[model samples]
Target: MRITNGAGLPAINEAPGAQIAEGPAIVPRSASAVRPAGDATTLRLSHAEMQKLPDVDSERVADIKAALLDGTIVFDASSLAARIARYHGGPQ
Candidate 1:
């Protein structure tokens, strides 16, 4: 049987108790079978690639920790308000 929508497009029509046919069962590949040796597609990170990451500034972190302990850290309210406004697409 055929069915048509309000836009006059043909749609599928199935009986109330009709069952859909199942497709092929998916089988997962074994761990070693997933990747073979000397595969060009495989990615490897070298020592230089690891060194490219930005190093944490321990001195600045210690200063921030000291300010937090002494309650000397100051936050800009106007800058935070502008950022919130921009995120919500409201007035600048």
Candidate 2:
């Protein structure tokens, strides 16, 4: 189902003196609150912090590169595309 930008909204906000009564805020006023989209994404990791990263495997990567260079490994494009599509819940 596709949702339009004006979904759940009236064609015109035809109110002159509409006042929202005082209530608890929908979002909290905190320093770590979520920001709007298109903000600059930055990743600042210190040496000790970077050492704690889980997904970086340089030795395994070097082995894979060597295998690919020596033609011991085959790169299957169709299988890779199918896996990516399944991962993103797209057309299989």
Candidate 3:
């Protein structure tokens, strides 16, 4: 999705390790000069970088799902109600 500034110009979205041009000429303050039509840039994460991320604990997720199914997961009803009331600007 493209984000626009107050002038409806496409916002500059920079990525890490990306080379950004220095000087006012390259980085224009005006909306029209920022990016012309047909100019598209894509950002992607490398496979090695993606591999550095942590894996989800499937066993723990399964346990939580089972607990939820059997209604064994405990919840504070009064606390939840108070939060709901606060969110709705009602009396706690």
Candidate 4:
């Protein structure tokens, strides 16, 4: 069911000023904390670099390269741990 404002208890905004003591004063935010919207930089590959690379049409290679460039590609910790376990065989 759709219920409008003041359906139950008294509306907060409509309440008396004495009932609502002033809340914590808001401190003005510093300029440094607010970053500009147009301040961001865009990344691009050089034309010469792109020309040097072959198979640009390959989706798999392009995806891998994009992931690496964006720092999304990470080392497989579980695989590394298993490999290390196999190499060590036992505790030192």
Model 1, TM vs. native: 0.28
lDDT for model 2 comes to 0.71
Candidate 2: residue pairs that collide: none
Best model per TM-score? 2
Model 1, range 2-60, lDDT digits (tens) per residue? 45679865456756777656765676788977757645433444555767866997888
TM-score: the better of candidates 1 and 2: 2
The C-alpha RMSD in Å for every predicted model, in order, reads 11.8, 10.6, 16.2, 12.8
Cα distance off (Å), candidate 2, residue 30: 34
Residues 25-92, candidate 2, lDDT per residue (tens digit)?
57577866766543533233355577698776999999999999999998999999999999999888
Highest lDDT: which candidate?
Answer: 1
In what order do the candidates fall by TM-score, top score first?
2, 3, 1, 4
lDDT score, candidate 4, position 46: 56
Candidate 4 on 1-92: residue-level lDDT in tens?
Answer: 22247568655556365454465667678998986764443223455566788766598888998998898997689888888988889532
lDDT of 1: 0.74
